[model samples]
Target: MSSRRARFGVFGVVALLAWGAISVVRPIPERRAGEVISGVRTPAWQERVDSLQRGETVGGVLSRGGLTAQEATEAIGAAATLDPRRLPAGMRITLGGPEGAPPSRISFQLAIDRFLHLTRSDSGWVEHEEVLPWATDTLVVRGEIARTLYDAFDEGATELPPGARSELAWNVADIYEYRLDMSRDLQPGDTFRVLFERRRGPEGTVRIGRVLATNFASGTASIDAIRFESEDGRGRYYDTVGKSLRSAFLRAPLEFRRISSVFGMRRHPILGVWRAHRGTDYAATSGTPVRSVGDGVVVRAGRMSGYGNVVDVRHANGFVSRYGHLRAFAKGVRSGTRVAIGQTVGLVGMTGLATAPHLHFEVLVGGTQRDPRKALASTGGDPLPSADRPAFDRLRADYLALLQRVSTQIADSN
Candidate 1:
C-alpha cells in the first residue's frame, strides 16, 4: 500500500510542472487603455467646465484650458457670430477632448436661451449658434394697488423671475393708456388681474410672453382688455365688445411716472407765484425718452422763453400737443416734419426755466391751453369689424374663464 501512494504523489508533481511550462510559453494578450472590452469602448474624451473671469479675453480662457495659442486663435476666428472680447464675466464655458490634450470642441452660453458651439473639422474649426426652445405656460396674477402699478406687480408676482413684474406692469399700462392714465389715475385700493404667458427654458429661466387678458378696477370704474389679432395680423388690446384700447393720443408723454404738478392753481417752483399752470409736469430722470402723444406735424422744435427746448406738434382738429424741457431734439424733428404717434421727439432735460428734470406736457385746443386728460379721453382706436366678432368673443370668454378659475384657486389656497 505504501509503495502505491508514493507512485501517485510523483505523478501529481510531474503534471504540475508540465502545466507551468505551457503557461510560460503561451501568455494571454494585454488590453490597451481605451480598448473595447466585451462590447463597450472606453470614452476617449473628458469634459471640463469653467467660467470667464473678469477682463479675460476668449483667447486667454482657451489657452488656460490646455489649448495651444494657435488653437485658441482658430477658435476665436470660428466664433464670427459673437464678439469674443465682449463675453460677460461668469459666463460658463465647456471644453471636451482627450485627457491632457487640446480640446477638439468648445461651447458657451450666449444668453439664457442661446448657445454658441465650436467643433474641429478636417479644414479648420466651424461654429454655429443654437437657439434653445422654451415651453410656455399660461398663468393668472392678481394684486391690489397700494401705491403704483409696479409696486402692486412686485407684491403680487413674487414668484416671477427678476424684472418680469416690471415688464408686466409696463405692458399692462400700455394696454390701458388710452382709457386710464396709469401714472396718476390709480388709487390705493385699486386692484388688477392679469392672464399672461410664462415661458420656461430648459435651464429653468423664465420670461413674460403675451398678456392674454387683464382687468383693472378703481373706485366704481372697471376696465377689461383682451388681446386679439386683427385682419392685418397685428395684435391689439380691445374691450369685451371688441373696441380697441388704443386712443388717438397717449395718456402721458413719458412712460409711467409721478405727476409733480397738475393743471390749475399751483405755486411755480422757480417763480414762487400762484398762477395758472396749463400743463402737467411728469418727474423723470434726465435723458428719459419723450414721445409724441399723437400723429402730427412739427410746428416748433426750438427753444422758447421759460420753456427750454420745446417741441410743438399740430394734430388733426385744431389740436396742438407740446413737449417741453427737452435736452435735445430727435433727428429730423424740425419745422414742417411729420411725426407719428409714439415717436421719440426729444429727451427729457432741465435745459430752460426748469428747477429740476421733468417733462411739461400741454394740450392746446384751437389756441387755448386745456386739461390734457379731459381733452384726450374721448378719442379711441378702431373697433373690431362685424366679421371678426365671433373670434373675439370666443377668445375673450376663454381668457376671462381662466382668470376666474385661477382667482378661485388662489383664494382657496389662502
Candidate 2:
C-alpha cells in the first residue's frame, strides 16, 4: 500500500512539472502598447489608408492624416525604397500593425499615363510594373460677375491662381478675338464661367487643359459658348448637346482699358490747338503693346508725318484699321503681312502730334473715317451653323447663370 501511494505522488509531481515546462517553452504573442485586448487571442491591427493627393508636401500628407512626424518618417523609411525627403505629394501609403507599429510594408503606385505597381520586399521596394485602371473626373465651375471678373470667380468658389486667371482671360480674349476686346469692354460687373479639362499625373499632379465652355456677360450684352474644340481630342466641352463654340472674330479688340480720347474733333495737346482728332486714343503706358483689332492684311507699315510709326490693316470687309503714335512696330509686322486680331502690331508712344504716350487708333468704313467706338456693323461673316446654335444657347445659359450667381454672392458679402 505504501509503494502504491508513493507512485501516485510521483505521477502527480511529474504531470505538474511537464505542464509548467510546456507553458514556458511555448511561443507567446507580444502585447503592444495602445493595443486593444479582447479575450485571449490578439487581433491583427488595421489602419485606415491615407490619400496621396498632389500639391501636398511629404510632411503635409502625413500630418494631415493623423500621423506624427516621427512615425511618418519611420514608416516611410521602412516601407518605401525612395527617399522620404523626396516623397512627392499625392502618394498613397498604407500603415498596418498595431496603432504605433512601424509600417510593415510600403506600396507605391505610379499614376502617370497609367498605374504601375511598386512594392517593398526584403530587398527593398521595386517596380512591380502591373497595369492599373485609367479613370477621368469632371468638375463644373460656375460664377457671376460683380465689380470685376476676378471678383466673380472668387464669389463662385472657383478662384484661380494669378497665372491661371491671366491665362484664362487671355483665352477668353483669343476666342472673342474679332468680336470683343477684353482691355476695353470688360465692364465692372462682367460675369463668366469656364468649363475645361484637368489632367492628373502619376504623382497626382493636376494639369489644366483647354477651355470647354465659356459665357461672358457685360451689361445687357452677353456671349455664350460660341466654340469648343481641342487640339488633342482627349476631351470636349460644349452646350447641352455637343457643338462648336468658336467664332471667327471677337466682338471687341480691347479689354479693361480706358479710352482717353475719341475719333472726332478734339483739342490737340502737343500742338496746343483745337483740331479734328481723326483717331481714338487708348490710354496706356508708353511701352504698352497695341494689337490688331481684326484679322487683315497689313497695307501700310512705316512712319507717317506727325503719326510717328504707323500700321494700317485692311479687312475682308471694306473696313480698315490704323494704329498711330507707336514707339515701334512688332517684329515681322510689315506691309502685305496677314495679322490676326489681338496680334501685337505696335507699341504705344508719345509719337506724332501727341503730348502724352497713347495709342492713336482709327477705323475706316468704305475708305471714310468713322467713329470706331460707335460702329457696330458686323464686317461680313456667317453666324454659327444650325448644328452649333444649340451649343451656343447652352453656353449663353451657363454664363447667365454664373452672372446671376456672382451677383448674389456679391450681394450676400455686402
Best by lDDT: 1
| Model 1: residues with Cα > 4 Å off, grouped in runs | 1-57, 76-92, 121-129, 257-266, 407-414
- Predicted candidate 2 versus true structure: per-residue lDDT over 23-89, tens digit per residue: 6787556989988767575656665567666656555565555557875565455533456555556
TM-score of each: 0.80, 0.50
The residue-by-residue lDDT of candidate 1 on 1-414, one tens digit each, is 999999999999988987888867775479889986677555578988888999888788888887889999988888888787678999988888876667988999888888899998898989988898888777789999997778899999986865888888888887887788888777899988998887777898778888889999888888899999888988989988788888788888876643443334468878888778888888777888889998999999999998999999999867999999898999989999999988999998997878888888899998899988888884557888999999999999988888776552222111
- Model 2 CA deviation exceeding 4 Å by range: 1-159, 188-208, 218-221, 230-279, 283-289, 336-344, 353-357, 373-414
**RMSDs, each prediction?**
9.4, 12.1
Residue 209 lDDT (model 2): 48
Clashes within 3 Å, all models in order: 0, 39
Model 1 TM-score, 2 decimals = 0.80
